[model samples]
Target: MSTLSLAGGPVSWGVDFADATGNPPYTEVLDGVASSGLRWVELGPVGYLPRDPGEARAALAARDLAAVGTFVFDDFHRPDAAGRVLDAVDAALDAIVETGGALLVLIDRPGEERAGTAGRATLAPRLPDADWARMIDLLRRSADRATARGVRPVVHPHAGGFIEFEDEVERLLAATERDELGLCLDTGHALYAGGDPAELVRRYGRRVEHLHLKDVAATVRTRELGFWEAIAAGIFCPVGDGLLDLDALRTALDETGYDGFATVEQDRRPGSAGDPAHDLRRSVTRLRAAGLG
Candidate 1:
């Protein structure tokens, strides 16, 4: 049997940025995660939780929840922004280490030009060769820092970013050594990018160190909205409530012997209506039913 572990994150509750306006208190988000029956979670945006390691650990422990990883979304393609991006990466690494987490999920912040062309792989602009090299070099440096700190760094190919397409993913994998970098396969983003999540699992195998189990609504393809707008339009739904084939993904994970944390994420606009705990519970129940829990 596969040894995949189930987890959740604050993004399901619309907490995208730590200092974003109108975010719920961190304690409330933790309560919601625990109430939904999740014992593991990802540390959502850097400052969303306590900055002090001890305080952050105590906060999660208080809820009977532990962090599995933290994410850093920055513009890595710009050579000028490399320093700032690494600083953000270091911050995320700090959260991971202090919270007893093992993974640092790296995402390229969505660029304005590509934001509206999220799922239109052919329409999205490709980065110049020089910029692409810069991005890869930045990722490698980030991975080196993460490994030195005893944390694993995984690159997440997110929608509306420079690295969202399968070809880009292929290039990235080709550029980086497997020992220094790994992949975080997100189901909704994979589908949104016109790639099969299960197929990706089978292809990547052990190189996929982490998972984000999300469902993309079928209606999403019909909309002409930007990435954030699509999120507000409910592009991402609870697992099994939309187009994700949970059974196939579970089979792929089993075949690959993937023993990693699969986090349930239903990204929403901040202050969006609907009870986060309720949606998360439904997702957890679906994952259990599909034999992924």
Candidate 2:
């Protein structure tokens, strides 16, 4: 059995992608995290919390919790998106350092609302090969910037993003450096994209610096509904309650001797509400039972 520190984030409660404007306040989410036995949390959607590093630090300190990473969704496919992407990353550095060991999570912003069974059929958005090269360059530069800030840069292959597919993930990983750029293997998205988590671990586990331990509901997964629609329908369920072969994934991580934080992420979007604390606690319990908590 391999043991790694378990963390939880605002996304666990739907206090996510849309940020504070769409969900509960930071303080409340942070409190929920602490109360739920999560020692670390992510600085979800940059502006969702107090922007100032000092203010952010104080808030987390008050709860005795810390920020493990920060998510930055940007239009990397746009030819001119690099500057804005770098700017977002720069803005996050101070707070990231303040939170300690926080990685700059770079996620490609899926431009449109991909919904329904059609959305499920097409997990990828159109990003030209030239644009992908440009994005890769930007990612390399982003890694440089993060290194300068004493933080790490992690590439997140989101389900609705341009890099949702396994081959896309492989290409990105091949272009980046294992020592500099890290991979944030989001289990739910990878599974949703039809990639085997255990195989991914065997292939690129060495570059994995962060993780989002999410489970896709087996029933909803087969429903073939669009990403957001499925998410809105409470499709990302508790660990053991879902279909992921977590034991196999855990064995893969154990083989790698993974020591980084594995934050239990149950994607909860607004209007798709439920008892998040209870769900998160259930995930923690399940992880512990699997010896990965």
Candidate 3:
């Protein structure tokens, strides 16, 4: 197996792409990353790329950054649902292939309001058993398609998204039975949802396809904040500055023998000086020392 390594992503830094000379051009963003001492990057989406792959590849080549994964959303159970879930996945897959990305991250689930109000109105319990089964089946099929095209399907759990709770995570994991259908372990989201990311890593390390290295700020005042609000408020702080225990997470990963890209994630606004490269460099250094990189 390949040794674990560090990689940078564009989402967490809240990059100021608007100010760059090449507005909305991936080359500019990737060039900045290369200058920041990163060898790999998780490109946000192909939509950010130029019309031609030649241009995209040339840009990345200049930075020596490899495309690791792409963020994707889909409804595993409702393939034919009114929503554009499947169509979105198809389009994302096409883009993933174009960018040489091998992983598609799943970050969507049924909305709780759609399920019904059962007190808290969580989506997990509201989902009909049959629909749950269909969703799992859909995921399995999606996994097969991705595998056929040399891409893996990784389920990313979000704090406020449809399947944010721990129970919902368990249900989704139990419903699927394919090696291709894996988990994208997200630290801050798990913490926000009152779930232990390290424990999940220990329990499902074999299924861990990717990772979103996030840290949460838990305080007397912020502990009760909603998930989305926390994200929008720059809830994710630097690795050691937050509530997650990196030592525990590293221990779990070591025990499980898991190997994958561990990308830093923070959603703070970009400073006037420029991109948050200094903060990201600090995070990478700390993560490497902790043995996650």
Candidate 4:
């Protein structure tokens, strides 16, 4: 059976970006993560945590939490922005490595045009051939840099991003060497993009190096809301209370001999009412009951 370590992240507490308005203090988010029984965490956005390696390490250490990785959401399809994106990746890499993190989750940030049509694969515009090639090249370079630093770089196909669908994911995998870039399979995002998580595991197997455990509300799947609007409407629910089949996912992982960190991510907006810790604790309990924690 695969050994899965349960981790948490600041996104559960609505801290997507450092400068995102109304973001709760980092200390509060860490407190909530540790309080909810998670021992590992991803550094949310670069500046959301302290930039200094020592300080970042100290922060996690203070909460009795170890670093699993960090998420870098940037536009990789534009050659003009490649330098800035790479610099962001390096910044994230520096902090993650210093804090004992192994995975660097790379996500193509969603543009306004794609954001509204997220999960509508038929309606979403495809990247032009040159832009697609640029994205693949940047992914290769980013993965190489992360590998050089002894960190595993995993491409995360986010709901509203350029690489959210099965075909895009397959294309990316075909273009990059497996050793250089692995996959961060996010359960909710996979379903939201109209793919089955277990089937993806059966197909990709070991290429999926990391996991993000999230549950999408089935009722929200057919809604016409934008990404952020859907989130605001409670599109992501607690584990076991939504559409994901945790049992099948666990079985698939075991069958494939997959072992790694599976972080529970319940994306929410900052300043939303209700205790985020309560939601996290509920997810941890449900996952444990499902034999995933």
lDDT of each: 0.89, 0.79, 0.66, 0.90
lDDT of 4 by residue, 1-293 (tens): 88899999998888878899999889988998999889999889989988888888889898899999898888886679999999999998988888899999999987786888888999998899999999999988998899999999999999888999999999989988887889999999998898999899989988999999999999998898788888888888888888899899989998998889999989889987668889999999998988887
In angstroms, give how far residue 23 of model 3 lies from its true place: 9.2
By the TM-score metric, which is better: model 3 or model 4?
4
Task: State candidate 3's TM-score.
Answer: 0.82
Index of the highest-TM-score prediction: 1
Candidate with the larger lDDT of 2 and 4: 4
Clashes of 2: 1
Error of 4 at 164 (Å): 0.5
lDDT order, best first, reads 4, 1, 2, 3
TM-score of 1: 0.98
Q: Please identify which of the two predictions, 3 or 4, would achieve the higher lDDT against the true structure.
A: 4
| Number of backbone collisions per candidate | 0, 1, 2, 0
TM-score of 4: 0.97
Off by over 4 Å in 3: 15-28, 74-83, 109-126, 220-223, 268-275
Candidate 1 Cα misplacement greater than 4 A, ranges: none
Model 4 scores a C-alpha lDDT of 0.90
